[model samples]
Target: MGATAIVTRFAPSPTGHLHLGHAHSALFAWRRAREAGGRFLLRIEDIDPLRCRPEFTEAILEDLAWLGLDWDGEVRVQSAHLPEYRRALDALAARGLLYPCFCTRADIAREIAAAASAPHGPDGPLYPGTCRRLSAAERAVRLAAGEAHALRLDMAAALALLPAPLSFAEGGTRIACDPAQFGDAVLARKDVPASYHLCVTHDDALQGITLVTRGADLRPATHLHRLLQHLMGWPEPAYAHHPLITDATGRRLAKRDRAATLRDLRAAGRSPAEVRALAGWPD
Candidate 1:
């Protein structure tokens, strides 16, 4: 394929140190961007000022550079780009696509419990849209009064806007996300203005990214991201979700898991290439 402004990014939050899963995700994006003769970029998803640490962000860069990963130009940090996210939020809110949510974590849990079938994954419980019943006028009144609220997308309306087959190219294969499979995703949290789903989609568009490579676990998320791209009037990029590196117990690597963290592995004498190989990444 010709280089159609093919760009890729590795946007990790500075909440913790870099781990195997992150390594795999970064390597795939870096490799594909190079192979396509496109630009590779790094983005710091550090908007969660409460949990994100400056030390951890610094460590992530050190680890990636140690692994021989190089990114182009100045890095993009979500915290540094607040105006952009707020602009998107305002635009969506203006279109009546975003709703103010007053529900807390416990409130969401009560909803899932009431539903009687709780399924847990890497991203946590699926929201049942408990706060969506509020009228747009009511939502505005609460927001104007300074009541803390999150920004959630109107899923039912958003779905109708997507085509039957949401299409993209991945590893030269045509991939499509069935609109029926994705539910409503919160675009921004009250704790911070940016959610992963929202930041990823908006930042990709903002960065002019055309290709994205990450773990297979995010395969499901691609649909929602694509749906969001359509709703937000942003272009969708080609994506490839590679297999995640699991431990001997078959559990996927986590940033907090000491065994899988690059710092821990490097101390144990594993070469950077060995770390990549163990994660099923190309040389």
Candidate 2:
């Protein structure tokens, strides 16, 4: 991976105002691209229609411009690329790696409660895989009845499809992958056409991203992403999961921390340079 053309992206969901934490992540990607004389891109992960807002997207563009971070190429908005994600899901479905899961939150909880033990994962208790055992007739009946359902990856089947010992490059180090830990992760929700894991991997490959830079918090998701890339035959990009920005209290900054927002800081007469420094990226 020496001296390869590095194309990196800073993708943020427009759920709220751009906070300091977002600034740090964006700057991290931007600086890496600039340092290598590569391209920096921006993408809006606005797939969740209920939470995402157009105003927030506009504010993101404005905030990044104010921070003096200019990206190359048109920003890829995930909401606008539903067809691509759909196609990816279709490919996996064709390979028998995906299945329709009709389990609602209440249904899953009921099954988990009935079970003596529930396996835990990084996110939470793993999905009990109740719907994965549904017979063909039962699934057809649910489908015919117009019952809502999400598309879930058959983790065991997917892993079996791939060769043993799947891995990815993390800061030039080869890290082994364990996608099975996610326990049949959702690929596409009933409401949304695709999940974060699906869309991000798809876009990275489509955009030919050579380096994926984001917060270390998403490192766990990388193992699963590696599996998706391998299954989809997408190019594996080098990953650099940077440390997250935190507040004085040692808590990770979030949208709820309005005072740490670029908008709030700008309103308080802080210069762009000052705000950049606050985000831990001083020129």
Q: How high is the lDDT of residue 252 in model 1?
A: 87
Query: Model 2, stretches more than 4 Å misplaced?
Result: 1-3, 257-259
Kindly give the stretch of ten consecutive residues in candidate 2 with the minimal lDDT sum. 252-261
- Write the residue-wise lDDT of candidate 1 on 1-283 in tens digits: 3648678999898988888888888888888788878889999999888999999989999999999899997999788888888888898778777777898888887789889686554466667867788776887788789999888887777776656657667788987765435445677888988788888889999888888777788787887788778878898788877887888999888866665588988999999989888767847
TM-score of 1: 0.88
| lDDT measured at residue 42 in model 1 versus the true structure, 0 to 100 | 98
Residue 63, candidate 2: Cα error in Å is 0.2
lDDT of 2 at 237: 94
TM-score to true structure, per model: 0.88, 0.97
- Please count the clashing residue pairs in each candidate, in the order shown: 0, 0
lDDT for 138 (candidate 2): 95
